[model samples]
Target: MNLFKYWKKDVPASLVVFFVALPLCLGIALASGAPLFSGVIAGIIGGVVVGLISKSNIGVSGPAAGLTAIVLTAITDLGGYEIFLVSVVMAGILQIIMGLLKAGVIGYYFPSSVIKGMLCAIGIIILLKQIPLVLGLSGEMESDRITFINFHEKISIGVIIVSVVSLLVLLLWDEVLAKRSNLFKLVPGPLIAVAIGIIIYLTMGQSGDLALNQSQLVNVPIPEDFNSFISNFTFPNFSALNNPAVYLTALTIAVVASLETLLSVEATDKLDPMKRQTPTSFELIAQGIGNTLSGLIGGLPLTQVIVRSSANVMSGGLSKLSTVLHGLLLLLSVIIIPKLLNLIPLAVLASVLLIIGYKLANPKRFVEMYKLGKEQFIPFIVTVVAIVIFDLLVGIIAGLIVGVIVLLLKSYTNSHSMLIKEFEGKKNLYHMNLAEEVTFVNRGSIVKELDALPQGAFLELDFRKTKILDYDILEYLDEFKVKAKNNNIQIKIISERGIVDDPHSFREFFGHKVFKMGH
Candidate 1:
């Protein structure tokens, strides 16, 4: 990393990613029923700490929305926020152990179809999640702050206008303006949208119902002094280490966090224009360190988030510097200019996410997948549907199961290929060729082909390329001999061993114990 070479690109990309990350951190914390500030802490640690150590060039880490349910349940069951932090710390330790054990190989097993499906599913989720926000369904009035925004009575007219126009800005930048000049390329669309949003808030938000509500703006906690800032973070209950529930929750968080991280790493690699592969094991250690630090300081457990990574890629972030810079920006924003940051509208950020979402789930990608045929398309579509209906982990497992079944079906059909020859002066002759390996699972396929043979036909069974022949297949061949004789069919068998006069001679030719051996 010239580290210095990409400052021009990374700076703008970092700003865009920072804005994208802020709401996510807050929202995920809210969903988890934890202090909203904890999400922000995790975001900062994930970016600055994990980003510093991770081998992945473009991946960005944060508190994942996927882990919200687990966090919520664990927090409730474990007694309180302080108790939950113990589990988070223990989870980080387990993750580090996994990394040392080289368990990262599992990341490679996911097929491209499933990976693409996950990316698209996440994109769709982003688009859907932002709809209400984009419409400015804010909650807080003048007096107090609200945890979650609701889509109740009325939508904001100002919010709608700002979202629409900001979305248009994003669209025009990507599809048209960015290509025309270096200036447009230098200024990220999200940053421009934010600036415009701030202007709108200042100009139209002095005093009226049309003003953006407190919930509609960024709401980071502002501390007056160092001691007060330190007081904002909650510490873990060390005594909870004795509880078995703590270990169980730790196991859950470690497993979920590791898996989500690997998935995001794979997806990020696919999205990278440079196509850099992250060292999965090393990445795990990085995440473990970040989580441990986050837990110690009373923050939510974190994972590599695909949405932020995709935003980084979309914004032209060229190095890990972008990841680090985004983290630094997050830290500075809450302390340095919390008031100024609050002026930024959530609707503009929603518009930014909506554009990134559309690009990920573009219709053209679906057409491309379909063109690859059903083997690829089926799992791709299934993963998308599963993720949309359920959650990330379930969707991936569903897709993996479907992918394997499709593979098995292909293997079954591909057991053998046949060629038929019939001439005016000769008998109808059929040649059946076997693949390199045949197993019991191919029984139905072979039976179907054998039963299709016509009466009085001369049949040639070729197994020269075969390396392994299962005993069940030999038994099936012996059974076929009886039918061949009944139909008055002449049969010849060929293999590396030699051509056999009797198909049933296989019993004597290949000993029972030798059936499993490869030629």
Candidate 2:
């Protein structure tokens, strides 16, 4: 049997993600000060290079939203696109070193709530930035320069009206159309909205009498020859290596990009239908290799982008082949029809992204997070607020710090000053007054106490009225059994369940017939 028989199942999803990837590649390149073709190059590399090496089942890597701010700053500070490429190359080397040092474990340290917060915040930011584009108000600057200042131009009332109407249409499609009409589900609503927007733009562009602002039109460079296409590629200046500022920029990019990649990988794994988790170490290695190649080829650094990954999963991607094919399409599209690609209207692409952004940062997300309990909710809200105020990395660090502090406080509150009390010269006569529910977070203190027991000692774990034992804590108890055996100590577990030497397998060790509770 073929190990990857599932590859065939991913065709539909791959096609959808490919369309999603296309506009994002171009738009992000526009957002960065890089050439438009360079964004396409990064997408091609991310899909072909990272996708091939990644252990993740559903994630799709490419030019990341997280790096837009960095790219904007680098392009200006370095005074040229070629100079920024050098920083990217150095960042890639740093990622490789981080992977070799086994820093992949860093991903596991982030609380799930905080990760969710980061995703939702990014969604909001993407939508906010796309507003001006949707209104055909992007022409304030030369087609080459993309900056927030471009929004200073007055947006025509007509464009605003059309954008609002388009947004409403999208909302209706997502809610009523998708559920009530069988055809709508099979054909993605975003694609249809894009087609409609393009039709509208074409109709309006033709009216010679209409006052059209320069910013409303999409500007795609038409490459005439093979030489022009090749010339589009940029190379880095390694001479920038000696600059302390370059090193700082490189470190910032490496750390933020790595964190974002890890977070995306974790989220994508959860969306896998088979619930298979990606290996963090393997993921880091793939990212390192992808970033190194991307930088070398005059492309942007990449991460496992959630937008692409979500599209992949929703479209029915079942294997990495889909991602690889998507990359191939990206590379082929720019090379074969650079002129044809320019026909796409910026407004149409804006509509598609607006829908995606809404899904990610929906108010329902907050409601869901709040329902997960205070432990999950507080950190989730904190992360969202911090990210909105600061950027991605600083917000995540702040969230993590708060999470740790919360964890420590919980530990202190639950920890009994006297975990165990003993009866002198009495065998199997020890007492432990634990809080109502025992968790593995308390395992450290409990294990330390257990380790100090004298040889030939009989242990008693008192849990006469304890309501529950967390699975993690129960696993720790299982390990303690082996430790007790090595020290010639007998453990007596006293619970409502009854007295037994082994709590985990007590019923089996004594008699399965005697225990009637859930396993």
Candidate 3:
């Protein structure tokens, strides 16, 4: 499908994507506690490698912000960055297996509320993690629990000045400038913000009062030659392959990355002017291969990220060439200008991430979910709270549990439709129409309704709508017939075959067929 027929469009699009990807690549890496260079490696591999294999012409892959929390937690729990790489490799292997087994359909089963909660939780974590960096305080001050910020910790006036200016430019560019001019649209807000940050760094970062801490800036191995550049790559510790934690983290990364990729793919395809469909099963395989290769070279886990892909489309990307080209640009930047890239202040990246977090957990989302009603809103809120309070996997599980319970409650309450009326001289008559598909889940409602019928009252069971009858319901009806006889209550069976002359023969009627909706 990718014949590179649109290089004119793809070229400019790739450059736009390169600009959008660079800071996010660095920010996510800092949040994940991995060596800063690894993010660049992942970004390069995501674009160059995944772009080649994915069925999506417009979907761009890269280091994801969503994975920052998981990556951070896993890196700490797994002992070191080298050991965490093993999980990334294992996750790629699992994703490959998932693709081979056609497990793409599994993503559809996850409730949207749960997915939203997970993203929102990650956003909150990102926002919290960046506060220290943005404030000019050491990241270690809030490295573990961001809530424990040191009130007395020294702050950098220079960092604050740069962050505020960067944030204002980003806001103005997004809300006022971009809509007004195509030039502004082509030039992304983040790129402008980061550039401003670099300008501040070069102009004032070396001064005595405005002096910046070395720890508060981007740090990449400034390779002097080809060999030195190659030497900068970090490899996974193979010995950690035997750890159970490695397997669990691997599964988590695989599931989350696959889900994110699928969601991004869906969004990109919808935004496609051509309305082209992406082959999801094959896309997962592409992600798997990208991740495996990335981990081998000490890169962060990769996903088909929505941010970069959106940038690609907005920049008029028409082919996978744009995606591949963007990756080459990232590769070339690190190799050709490592020293220049290192001058970027961590605070500037912090401002970019801060906006990302706000977008994810915007208060409007809560109101939106509430308007959806309790059935949806409960699971959505539960998932968000759980993820924020605990971890990603546990939160999703919690949401699913709540979702299932709500489903069952609905089934129990709505098994049958009914109306109560009196005929000539009849004191009480119950007419109930069962649902189209009656299963064991409706048994309790059926039994309770049957027992609650007034003595000597006329009760009618209408099976005309019911097509699939569970044996449990059928058995309950059979036993209820015996009780109806003793209680002197009249029982009527209304099947598609028409009204039964005798209730005793109702069970026997099933011997021929459950219902005779038609001849």
lDDT of each: 0.87, 0.72, 0.80
Rank order (by TM-score, best first): 1, 3, 2
Please give each candidate's TM-score.
0.92, 0.72, 0.82
Q: What does candidate 3's lDDT look like per residue over 286-373, in tens digits?
A: 9999999999999999999866776677667888999999999999888887787678787877777677667666788889989998
- Could you tell me the C-alpha RMSD of candidate 2 in Å? 9.5
Clashing pairs in 3: none
Best by TM-score: 1
Q: What digit string (tens of lDDT, one per residue) describes model 1 on residues 1-519?
A: 667688898999999999999888887887789998899899999999999988889999989877888999999999999999999999999999999999877899999999999999888877777777777775331100112356675888888878888988888987799898888988888888899889988888666866877878888888999998888799999998899999999999999999999999999999999998999998899999988999999999999989999999988898999999999999999889988888988899888888888889998999999999999999999999999888888999999999999988998999999988875644588889998888888888999998988898888889888877888888888888898899988888888778976566566666664354453
lDDT of 3 at 250: 96
Worst 10 residues of 3 by lDDT: 140-149
Q: Evaluated with lDDT, which candidate comes out highest?
A: 1
Over the stretch 261-294, how does candidate 2's per-residue lDDT look in tens digits?
Answer: 8888776776688898788867877888888888
Sorted by lDDT (best first), the order is 1, 3, 2
Q: Return the number of clashes found in candidate 3.
A: 0
